[model samples]
Target: MVTFLAIFTAFLIGFLITPVLILVLKRLNLIDAPGGRKIHNGFIPSMGGISFVVGAIISVLTWFSMSQLIEIRFLLTAFGLMFLLGLRDDMVDISAWQKIGGQLIAACIVVVFGDIRFSSMYGFLGIYEIPDAVSYGISIFTIIALTNSFNLIDGLDGLAGSVSVVTFLFLGWWFMQAGMIGFSMFAFILVGGVISFLVFNWHPAKIFMGDTGSLSLGFALAVMTILFVDSNGNMNDYEGWKFSAPIASGIALLIIPIYDTCRIFTKRTMKGKSPLAADKSHIHHFMMRMGLRHDQVTITIVLINSFFIGMMFIGSNLNDHVLIPIIAVMAVILGLRLDVITLSRVKKIHRETPPILSLRERKKKASKPNVNKEILEKVNLTQN
Candidate 1:
């Protein structure tokens, strides 16, 4: 009941705050312009993330105690830093390195002050406990990787928000079953914010989450993922919430973003281009090119993500060593097939379209209107 109220409060706050934020952003002339590689039309406000941030923070502070506040002070501080960084990026574009540096700083805060580093590998690859240095390194890398993965998957309307809702809901349910009310509260609070934002960010979007939302959301998910792994690794006798392969389950839950990022990076590197260079090669873009509208693409991706989550549940009894490899292989195969299918479809489209004339040919053809008219008359007479 308390959990439901928390989610509702956050939702209501987000619902009420978004329109005002949109209006303010419009008045300030802070909007994302559509052109070249962008899918949206016209100028839409890009700071809708601020509403979710405000809503989630207000709900968290209202429900959590001072002790709980202290426990998560560093995480909150990191979130604030990420939000500010994203706002700055949205307002004035920042260099990729600058954004990465900010992410690194936020990740370090959580790892150091929050003490949320991964301490064990949960017996994957025949490794159980790792060195402290190694743990910190892995934790920092995982945080930054997952953070950017979420950012990269935020291309289409409602894709990021919808994917996030599914992830948090799954995590929230697991946390509740594990009797981890605090983490569950955090998950549902975030869910509420993202869900409310989705109302304005659906197809034919009036507002985009922009960097403000993506960065903050990425940071939050990264933190939650680390916590989820850490908590599950330590749980031995938890009846309703024990996983034989927590890391595999986490990977399954985030397969879409993780796999998509890897696919894009690999393709970019192979083409001798910077991985950060933006292009219309994202999975969502390919799906759109295959004739799926924005809403259809979003729904399809969400359902795919849910399917992976279900697979994880069904395979929960499997060993980590066995399950991780299967998931990885499946992801790679799926990505390869998507690329192949998209290319095939693109070729089919080109074949179906009329051939284009060169400039010289077009000019020469235009100069001979009498011959073209005669040909057209003959064709019309034949049709008659």
Candidate 2:
């Protein structure tokens, strides 16, 4: 009952605050403009993340005690840093290096101060334990990677937020079953905040989460994932809470963003482009090209994510060697098929509408205004 109240309070706060934030952003001319590579048609406020952040924080403080606050202070501090970084980027474009540096620093804080580093492999690849140095390295890398992966997946309207909502719901359920009420409450609080944000972020979005929301969310998820894996490994000896394959289960839960990021980065590198170079090659973009509307694409991806989570539950008794391989193969096959479809569509479009001139020449022609011979003649006569 207390958990229910927390969730509802968070949701109410987000739902109530978003419209006002939207108005404030508009008044300040803080909007994301639609143009090349963007799908939206008009300017939409990009700082909608602020509303949910406020809502989630308030809900968390109301439910948590002073001791709980001290225990998770590092994690909360990291989240705050991410939020600020994202807010700055949304207001004024920051360089890629700067954003990455900020992520690294935040990740380090979580590992060093929050004491959330992975201490073992959980018997994956026959390795039960690892050195502290190696553990910190891997933990920091995972946090940075997961954080950026979430940001990368925030392309379409409601896509990122919807995926996150599904993820938090599953995480919350699992944590509750494992008797980790604190983590469970945190996950549900996030779900509440995101749900309210999604109310305005659906199909025709009224506002975008921008960097603030995505970065903060990604950071939060990273922390949660590490804690979940660590706790499950430590409790594996227990009867009711043993997760037979924690590593594999974690990967399965985050398969969509992780897989999509890897695939896109590989494609970009193959084309001799920087892996971070923005383009319309994400799976969501491919789905859009395949005639799926924004809402349809969001819903489809959410369902696919849920399906993978269900797979994790079904295969919980299997060894990592068996379950991880199966999941990896299935994910790879799906990615390849999507790539092929997207490539085929691109080739067909090129074949049907062959370019009449080079890109530079086309640009020149487009820039010049058209004047018919009769119009020119009339102008000449009038001048004479």
Candidate 3:
């Protein structure tokens, strides 16, 4: 079908373009160096997001018409702006406020121009219809917050791309079932791009998506979420496929990133630190401290997200008021448990590994003398 072809085209383009981008990024020395919050070794090419973003754009344009789908233009426009902002930040790191300002502008374009704002809360706490101004504000906040949430989770190899693939797959299938072909196409197209990128972005990753992929893809996911909530809210009870707790269901799909971001922000604020200050307080970081490998942590988080999505489907009969609270409680419990267990593991590791030995191990891990000189030369070619 046309949909499958679009996905295939995007996949093929991403699969082909990623290696070239990796080569170019390394040649240009546009690589992420491991230090501080970064847990990787040596240097790895970044901004590899360009490959998949271009692939998705080309694939969408090849099959979708602007005239027929006017909103698609606005969506793509906002997407491009987010991508550019992220690409710029990746090249020469931008201040946090500047990045947020860019996200705000992109969010405004989608909400004000594309009219993708949430119209209702679907009876969560007896709130049905929202005021226009309130709706716009909430929608814009949601978009920007979710955009950063996804970006924040891009800490581990394959984490962001894997989460994205899971989100889009669910959204695409749901959109198709909801009779929204355009939305389904949009989701599936990006799904292909991210999946292909995962080929080079898995454990021992050769490349990172950087902000380029995270911001744009996260923005797109936010847009789809708004659409999903709005469309589901308007559905009648006669529609057998309609979920009673659309808002909660959408939250379930994004619980991992959203919950993690909110928790980290709160923890930082309570400790009198800037919420945006980069640290290892993330759930993934804690999991890693608990001795989980990169791939294992990524898969575990993905499974956790899938579990929430499955719960949403099974609890379709529940209203947002009940289901949302339950989800929040569960998330809080899970986060607390993870933090407690990781702390114990960290203490155990400290006890097992003497401080002198730890320092030596850190030095050995940080310096990769065994790496091929030719490979280093190839990556640092432009330096000379």
Give per-model TM-scores: 0.90, 0.88, 0.90
* Ranking 1 against 2 by TM-score, winner: 1
Best by lDDT: 3
Count of clashes in candidate 1: 0
lDDT string, candidate 1, 142-202, tens digits = 9999988898888889999999999999988988898767778888999998999999999
lDDT of 3 by residue, 266-365 (tens): 9999999999888999988889988889999999999989989888888899988888998999889988887888899989997887689778988998
Q: Report the lDDT of model 3 for residue 7.
A: 96
Give the Cα lDDT of each candidate. Answer: 0.88, 0.88, 0.90
User: Residue-wise lDDT of candidate 2 within 118-152, one digit each (tens)?
Assistant: 98988889998899999999999999999999988
The CA lDDT at 368 in model 1 is 75
Q: Ten residues in a row with the worst lDDT in model 3?
A: 64-73
Order of candidate numbers by TM-score, starting with the best? 3, 1, 2
- Runs in model 3 deviating more than 4 A are 65-68, 238-240, 355-384
Order of candidate numbers by lDDT, starting with the best: 3, 2, 1
Instruction: Give per-candidate clash totals.
Output: 0, 0, 0
Judged by lDDT against the true structure, how good is candidate 1? Answer: 0.88
Which ranges in model 1 have alpha carbons more than 4 Å from their true place?
355-384
